[model samples]
Target chain A: MTSEPLVLGIETSCDETGVGIVRGGTLLADAVASSLDEHARFGGVVPEVASRAHLEAMVPALERASREAGVRLDDVDAVAVTSGPGLAGALLVGVASAKALALGLGKPLFGVNHLAAHVAVDTLEHGPLPQPCIALLVSGGHSSLLLVEDVTQTVTPLGATIDDAAGEAFDKVARLLGLPFPGGPYVDRAARTGDPAYVVFPRGLTSPRDLERHRFDFSFSGLKTAVARWVETREREGQPVPVDDVAAAFQEAVCDVLVRKALDACRTHGVNDLLIGGGVAANSRLRAMAEERCGAAGVRVRVPRPKLCTDNGAMVAALGAQMVARGRTPSGLDLLADSSMPVTVVAR
Target chain B: MLLLAFDTATPAVTVALHDGRSVLATSTIVDAMRHGELLAPGIATVLREAGADRSDLTGIAVGVGPGPFTGLRVGLVTARTLGHVLDIPVHGVCTLDVLAAAAEVDEGQVGSFLVATDARRKEVYWARYSDRRTRVDGPHVSRPAEVATPDVVVGRGATLYPDAFPNAAGPLDPSAADLARLVATGSVPVLEPVPLYLRRPDVAEPTARKSVLTAR
Candidate 1:
């Protein structure tokens, strides 16, 4: 039997510089160096700051990953990297680093898509993916439902956010609530003790009229505006805002809409399995709601652990291992980091 | 000593392969927005032209630019990665110095001249250099109109604002051969491969924390 291919993956698509090593289906190392603290004061990631941080963290992350994996750099069979759908400067850092490794070690290079990697990461945890699974990818930068016939091959776009991404809305609303920079987890925590029915926040794109047209598509900008207006009006009336209630209501609305639409896509496509990935998948509310709703809908739900949901190199390595096992062609040396690379193209 | 050098700080992407004494091969392409796409292929081409395998490279050199943040990071990251993977020392050279050395080589006699390159937003990245091809002062970004006119000016920045620099020579971009030569000659200080972003980043941090409670 052929030994499993050892792949080293690099991901600096955003604020995290991640490096991971995988031997076929088994994960050896997953090391992440986040610049989240640097971006915290800014309330959002500054692209230039993230880029600078990646340059500093990349070498160290690689070293750590190799050491953790107990694999020497020379032993890795191939290199994989996230090529796009991220900050251009950030993506370039990982891409350049991947290229150098591929060139230096004389290994094959795989430039994988960031979004698809999110979906592919589940395979590492849940064994091989059930074909024709509906994947809901929610993060600060993107929110989309993808129909995956094969994580390594075809991923069909079902619907996506027409306005602000789900995580962006969380961050903005969290700011209004005086929460932290990356507001998802904070908002999730704040919502725990509050009443979800205190105020009925609008569930975006769920109106009967919207369902007829944009049933799968999402729009959160209006919901964000509504939250802001509600807060401002309470301030104008000199009423003390019930921050906990507001957090709970907002989280309920967002999760309700997300889970509703994701299950709808699964039903429409006749897919029995649903997978949720990306940073927003780390939200406790989203996970619980998705599991409950999908359970009732007779759709099996698959979500990697929270650590795997966020941006990491292990996902890229998993996808790369899949590509190699399936005999997919490796990317040429001239591969470019495409910031707006669509989710359909898994590799470039 | 087999060396591989590249620069993507300017609009052009340059790559070169060199021995200690002479450049074995070099290629430069003026591609404004495609540095990420062009650079790896350019390196492969140069290495092939020089009849050297990628594994044969003993060291890597790259331009640590005072250029646009996006383009400049590509070369630096690439150099650093190569160095880390190959276990070789990566040398970082000021891109402006490469242009100055090129100018000196081209003109044979170089007095005090300014090396300027496009910094976008109508500003130029300018540095003063002496006749010995040494960087005298300023890897600064300034409005072309505010820059002190020099006896001779080199680079795309001088050509762009002709009225500001009337004595400006024709266009010049940093070359890969010069980047390789800088490492070969040991004329310039080889600093840690950190980006020379002379200006503060555009994004600002939040000034004051928002109040969670209303004063009322």
Candidate 2:
């Protein structure tokens, strides 16, 4: 039997330095070293702090990934790394480390997109993505919709959030409620025990009259402020605030808008397959709502395991493997890290 | 004993080839914030001029800084990767130690000295060396005036903030020869070199929160 190609993936776009090894879409190992605890005190990422954390975690994460994959470093056939759309300092650590590995091993190098990797990871779990699908990438840093025609070739932007992203809204609202740093999970948990209709928070960019104007676009800054103002008014009036009730109401507003927009795009574009990826996709309420709404609309929804829902190396490597399988060209040694690398094109 | 040393701590890419006997060739390109564009090409030119290549390297040395985040990553990453590729061990010498090694101090009198480098954002990256010329405390970003020190201060960092370091070094006196010599001694620690980004990025996306003054 011919040995399958061993593709190693490295990701350091954010607080986590993740490394994973895969063989023909089969996940062998997935290791991540997170600096979430370090940033928890600040309630948001400090770029400098995140960069230093990447430098420290790079070597150790790679070692753990190789060990778990049960393969020596030399056994790796190709290397894939996330090259953009992140903190420049943080991105450099992963890119530079990857280049060195690729140069040393004399292996082919593939620079994968962090956002595309989020979409590509689904193939690892669900076999293959149906072509002509829409990808709703909602993370702390990004909230955009894309029309993905292929895993390796085409990803055209459908729409994106105009102001604060969906995840950022969760974080901001959570802070207003005096919750933890990562508001997504905290609010999701708190909402389960509370009532969704208690506050009647606004759903941004959603109006029957304005439906034709921004059918696919999203806006969360208004939602975030609305939550803040509601909390402030309760405190000012000395009306005892119900944290759970507020959390539930805020989460419902976000989910309601997200599902409604996604379904609208699906119906308009006639693309029935909807895929959601990123950190906020890990929210239980969002997952349940997506399932319920997609079912009612008779549209299919594919979401990776919760672990793959957030940033990870497996997604980057999976994207790389798919590119290699399709004979996509690799990036030049001089490829610069575009901190704002768009979610379109491969090996630029 | 062949040693390859380079620093991207500043806008300049300084490359040196030392055969343990003498310095063969030292080349520098002053492109300051263009390290991502000039570093590799500068490396190629330096090695070509020295009549050597990656295979001829025995040990690699790098200035593990207290420098700008993006620029410092290039040098450290290149040095570490090169060390791994050549199967030669790598050594990380402090940027201040390299500067101190080049100081024109009195031959027998190792007086108290301060080494400061521009830490950007109206601050200096500083470390103090005593009579033994041992580092006291730093690789941190602080006002030069605030970096409690004994006497004469040195390094380009002090030069950038003149008022901060009243007694500072003359110019970019930091040489790769000094870095090469330190690596040969094997005295510096092998800890992974981290870019000393002491603070967060200055710019953040605008938050939609009402101004605190408005709330008040």
Candidate 3:
């Protein structure tokens, strides 16, 4: 390997087929193909549909990334792939692809964790991470709080959603509001013009008693039920539903609980740096709220650009480069895709 | 043409390395729920036993399935990825054809038989093939009782429902060697590596929008 290894990363953990090329800490190319439009009719991502889409898009995305990077496939020093905590069939496409690439090119392979990759991505936008930082990951499938001593090595999970993930909550609430699929952005847009104080939505897992037992853990199912019940009551009363207000109120509740717990974890753990990631981190309200709260707490906040926050191969590439630079051992040819791979195993 | 072939459409995971004429090495493991974990190691073991390396592969042949969604994609995606990286052509063969081609039949024998594999949900994915190994009919999914019985039946589906198929024959799962052989001899059409999901997916699109207002 050269002083700056050129690593190619493949991510098909969900509905997106992403390929990225990176040299050391610098990103050269990032290409993504999404099956969001196909899943829209279903109101959510269908695992089978997502898996089929990945098979169709993997080759094109790889070619596009390589072309955009201005590098040949043989020039890559290593191959990295997301191998877990995703839809089973979806994860297989990327893992299998990475294996083939590594075998064919005779390069080292790294099977990285999807969640830690989210935390590692911030390093690409902002320099190397400060040791022992806290990360809040909110996505369609997962929501968790992690303590990262080193993204390339160790990650400790502090808490996770007990029920629906943050993104899933948004999608369910958006459907109740008669909004389109992928409710995060639509809810954000609708919340922009409305009053956040319209209705007092429940803040789940934040009560004094709840905190004593599960401090950092989150629960959005109760909040989702609250929103659904409120809308149902309004309909039963023959009242025109205030869609914007409900959206604003719901968004407020989610952001409030998320920001509160994240900061709490940092304060309690005596860690000063905090990073927010995952698809839901792309929410404008969440970003602003996190920044504001962290600013007040004298804690530094790091969030990657919106594109990096969502599922992308650049994150995997970034993580892979760090592993290579640190002189970590590459995975054997028999690496497997662990559908329920925990966040602590950064690489396997 | 040197080739690597594998199939994960059934409980059995089969991997083989073959030259144009004969199979060098083959391994088949019957692991019900470990296809994702077992496939790569299986491939590596076969390559080692065959005294070959990954770089020696000239092509890849995969079993595209009318089988379970999760297990079927494992083989196809791996083949596609290997093909893309090696810059070689990849061929997709119908899994049922792999089993039919491996059947032992006399050269002059002229008859039609059924090749059925388990499709889960109390159904089987089956097709009809002549003694010459040409697909004569089917590639359909239906209940075992509903399918019209042929003179001879083969594959896991036959063993699954013995009463429906009294005349069952050799081999349950498709052999990886047969997949390579079929690709080498041009016995099956080389189609796009798209999966053959015989039935619709389990999930469905939303039928209508929920109303915000209820009748007073």
Candidate 4:
């Protein structure tokens, strides 16, 4: 039997310099060096700090990944790197390193999209995805829906957030609630003991009037504003704001709107398969509600493990391997980093 | 002995190779924003021009910066990787020292000198040095207009904000020759090349969970 192609992936789309090695769908090694802590104090990623962290971490991560994979750098068949949709400086570090490694090893280089890789990663864990699935990606930098015909080719965007991604909203709201930086995990923890149905937060861009015009699009900025107003009112009235109740209620509002739209897309496209990716997919409420809703609609849903759900190198590698298997062209050494690179571009 | 030296802390990427006593090859690409894209190719070209391969490398040297995060990473990553691949020890020379070295050799001055490079966002990475102890004064990210008194001020940061240091401090000459000499002699120190990000990223992601390393 022939062996699977050995693919090495590098990710520097954000604060982490992630290096991973994969044999087909099996993850051989995953090494991530994150500058998240440095960014946390600033309440976000400092572009300059992230770029430097990626630079310092690149070689060490590559070495760790190689050792973990039990393979030499020369053994890597093709090198894949996240080339865009991130901090330009951060993305460049990985791109430049990948180019050097590829040139030195005489291997092909595949520049993959940070967002599409999130969707592609489900294949590594859940096996091949059903054709024409609706993909909902929610992360610190992005929130979008895609009609993915195949993981390697044809990712058509349906709609996206106009302002303030869901993850950003979560962080901002958590901060407003005095939860902490990186609001997702904080809200997730607080919601565990509170009631999700306690307060009715407005569903952004989902009103009966707005739905007709921007049905699939999302807007978390308004929702974040609503949370801020509610907290202000509570403080004005000399009332102690129950943290768990607010966390649960706010999370429910977001989860309810997200699930409703996701299933609506499934029905609209006549597709029964729905795939969830990105950091927000780690939400317990989102996962539980999605299972409940998709089950009732007879639609299949797939979510990767928590580690894979967040920004990492394995997903980029998985997408790159798919491109190679499908005979896709490799990128030139002159490939530049695009901080706002659109998802439709194949990264050639 | 042949050594490869480069610095990406500033917009300009300067590369050089020294064969023990003299310079064999040197190249500098000026692009404040494209250090990551231009650095590796520049290094490869410099080495090729010197008629040296990876196996011929005796040591690798880089100017570890208090510079912009992006450019600094590109140089450090490339130098460290080259050193690891070639199985040679890598040295990190302060960007200021490199400037001082260049000043000493080119200007033929034998006294103290001050070096400063732009840290962007309205700040400068500054340092002070003499022939004996190279005193790294401030890697602080602050406005150049606010730099304190110094003996000599040089590098692009000084050129951009001349008012930052208006004393007879000395000459403001910028060159790559000193970096080359440091690489050849293994005189630079060995330190972690992490960026000196004085502030946080614009967006914060809360990490309340204790680290896995600490949890167990």
Give the whole-model CA lDDT for all candidates, comma-separated.
0.89, 0.79, 0.88, 0.79
Candidates 1 and 2, the one with greater lDDT: 1
DockQ of each: 0.54, 0.29, 0.56, 0.22
**Model 3, C-alpha of B31: deviation from truth (Å):** 2.0
Q: Which parts of model 3 are misplaced by more than 4 Å?
A: B105-110, B148-150, B207-216
Which portions of model 1 miss their true places by more than 4 Å? B104-110, B206-216
- Best of the candidates, DockQ: 3
- State how far residue B137 of model 3 sits from its true place (Å): 0.7
Q: In model 2, what is the error at residue A112, expressed in angstroms?
A: 2.4
Q: Residues A1-348, candidate 3, lDDT per residue (tens digit)?
A: 336999999999999999999998888999999999999988999988899899889989989999999999899999999988788789988988888788778899999999989988887889899889999999999999999998998999999999999999999999999999999999999999988999999999988999987899999999988888899888878999989999999999999999999999999999999999999999999999999989999999999999999998999999999999899899876677788999989999
Which residue pairs of candidate 3 clash? none
Ranking by TM-score: 1, 3, 2, 4
Q: Write the per-residue lDDT of candidate 3 for residues B1-216, one digit (tens) a residue.
A: 679999988888899888988999998998767777778778888889988888788998899977787788878878887888788888888888888887655536537888889999889999988763688887899999998484678789988988888778767988898888888878777777778888876787677645544566
Which has the greatest lDDT? 1
DockQ of 4: 0.22
> Candidate 4 DockQ category?
incorrect
DockQ of 2: 0.29
Off by over 4 Å in 4: A37-43, A46-57, A103-106, B18-24, B50-52, B104-113, B121-123, B128-153, B162-178, B186-216
* Residue-level lDDT tens digits of model 4 in A1-348: 978789999999988889988888888888999898887776767887787678778888988998999988778889999988988878888887887677556689898889889998898899887888999998888888888887776888888888988889889888878887789999999999998888899998888998988898899988887778788778767999999999999999888888888888899999999999999999999999999999999999999988998988888888888888788899876667778888888565
Error of 4 at B72 (Å): 1.2
Chain A: TM-score in each candidate? 0.99, 0.97, 0.99, 0.98
